[model samples]
Target: MRRPGSVRTLLSCLSATSLSVGLMALGGGAALAAPDTPPAAAKPMPAQVVAPYFETWTGQSPAELAAASGNKYLTLAFLQTAVPGSCTAYWDGETGRPISKDTFGRDIAQMQARGGNAVPSFGGWSADTTGTELADSCTDVDAIAAVFKSLVTTYGITRIDLDIEGDSIDNAAGIDRRNKAIAKVERWAERTGHSVQFSYTLPTSTTGLQANGLAVLRNAVDNGARVDVVNLMTFDYYDGAPHDMAADTATAAAGLHDQLAALYPKKSSTRLWNMIGVIEMPGIDDYGPEETFTTEDAVTVGKWAAAKGINTLSFWALQRDNGGCVGTGGSDSCSGIAQDTWYFSHTFEALTAPHHPHH
Candidate 1:
């Protein structure tokens, strides 16, 4: 489902500030002309890098993860509630889930140890919580603002990613609701005078009416959200048989890139980050009983995205494939479908290697 190549073409078309402004307006920002000063020549695109908003789950200690990953640019905690339970703001530690506040402190400590940035991600695939509810109850605009202030004060997190997903998108009145929620968060951050980065994860493709998809992103930006990066779900494109992993990722990325380019031109500032799904969920679709992705396939997808100028590549999960799954032969083997995970790390290293252009 990840189409990096197509996204690249979309990036190419965004050469005019008016178009960029237009797309921003579509996302909900008021239009402004490109600055009158001659814009500086575009900086050479850096070699694609891994913006690992590392997903931390139950049984994994933040301290351990910091040691393992060596503290990257962004570390994210994937918080969720079991089925039939409504969303809650804090992590249910008793249930092994870390609350936002808890995760924030632990992650900050880990980042300090590992030397990378840590931020809290509110939701995941099963997260059905609404931003409005989070803002209204747990922390009002001012309190929420204060919380972030404390985060910067205590742990020095420079970014915060809002990874809300699932049916909650459909609950929105329109793009405006999503934009307003994000705007509230952004305004709070701004009021605190912190240069915090904001990002979101939408649906992989245009399948649902859920606001967590591309259409919702288009509407959110059109209304007034000031999100910095839009990370598209590039995996889970097929359900049945294992689809051609590279092809699907490229297609998803390309499609998303094109859509954004059409809507916003010349705004390369809004970078496109690709999410590659490495977890092999079988029997869910036509992809057969079970199948796993190869590391080579993951690398191919990354290479394709970079060739097209889409520099960011993130993997869906970190834990699922630690042991090989269905189509991957034996458990713990890194060959066959299991290779997909191995390739993800390898590809990231290769892409971000020193002297590599397009970082």
Candidate 2:
């Protein structure tokens, strides 16, 4: 509910270590999509991959995000359409117009000028048609592509994240339409000499992506879309256990490593790991202590991912990284757990410090 695959048969078809060479031997199975003809230019990732979600909460802004972590990447959350099918207008009031800039537009420009860039994340639990919902309302894939193209062109963003969750993740038709629309965008990028990377942000089980989530990723590749990253929202399992948060995270990421290796047969183990992202929800979750994610856990997971070369590391809203809570329950502004200001943020940010460039 928050910020939020495949298997043995394929292993017999090819080896995980030398998957790149095995694609031709296997005639390009489900794992391969016969690299696009003439080969399209590779879509690019963010200027800096590690970006925390910045959204509705007190004490959180683009400037706050830039100032807090000192990192170059920040994900400006929830850029959706004003209406389900109204592609020309965005939910943030920055309609495809000139002169007047909405809060998001102004702040993003400011953040960019500070040597930091942002990824316009489409979707969240809030109102507005998420990326999938917007695509579902339109049958014209080109139109859908145009909406995203305008966003990337206007904002100068190199990547966009599709945070698919709730009803949107299971909408099979929407998933297919969304994938087709993304494929069109990739093609458009190829023609325009712009590098754009598309990332899917979804929920995960301890073992990795659940069935619907797996389907979402498969839909992307089956429809001829290249997924640059698969970011897992690794909290709120809601199983009601006092689980070892960091251990679960490492296990979940390992499972995803295997799945990515299976999905992209030609990718090396290290490269596949580099395409994985983990989004942590700092402090006590809505489920309380049964699902707590402490700062110590953040450090553990950060070091684990850094050592393994994980693509990006982020968390839920940065507003919750403080200690304004009066009790141990979920709050939008501050972490329910007892902690100092910016404890989680600083710990996780340290994982991406200069000495740890591999992260």
Q: Pick the candidate with the highest TM-score.
A: 2
Displacement of residue 285 (Cα, Å) in model 1 is 11
Total clashes for model 1:
49
Best by lDDT: 2
Tens digits of per-residue lDDT for model 2, 56-142 = 222135665668656557776655555555544343323332211333445555566666567777665442123324665556777
Worst 10 residues of 2 by lDDT: 5-14
Off by more than 4 A, model 2: 1-48, 56-60, 92-101, 127-132, 357-359
Give the residue spans of candidate 1 off by over 4 A: 1-49, 52-55, 69-74, 80-88, 92-107, 129-154, 174-178, 206-212, 238-242, 266-291, 321-343, 357-359
Per-model C-alpha RMSD: 12.9, 13.1
Give the clash count for each candidate.
49, 0
Give the TM-score of each candidate: 0.64, 0.80
After TM-score superposition, the amount by which residue 204's alpha carbon in candidate 2 deviates from its true location, in angstroms, is 0.7
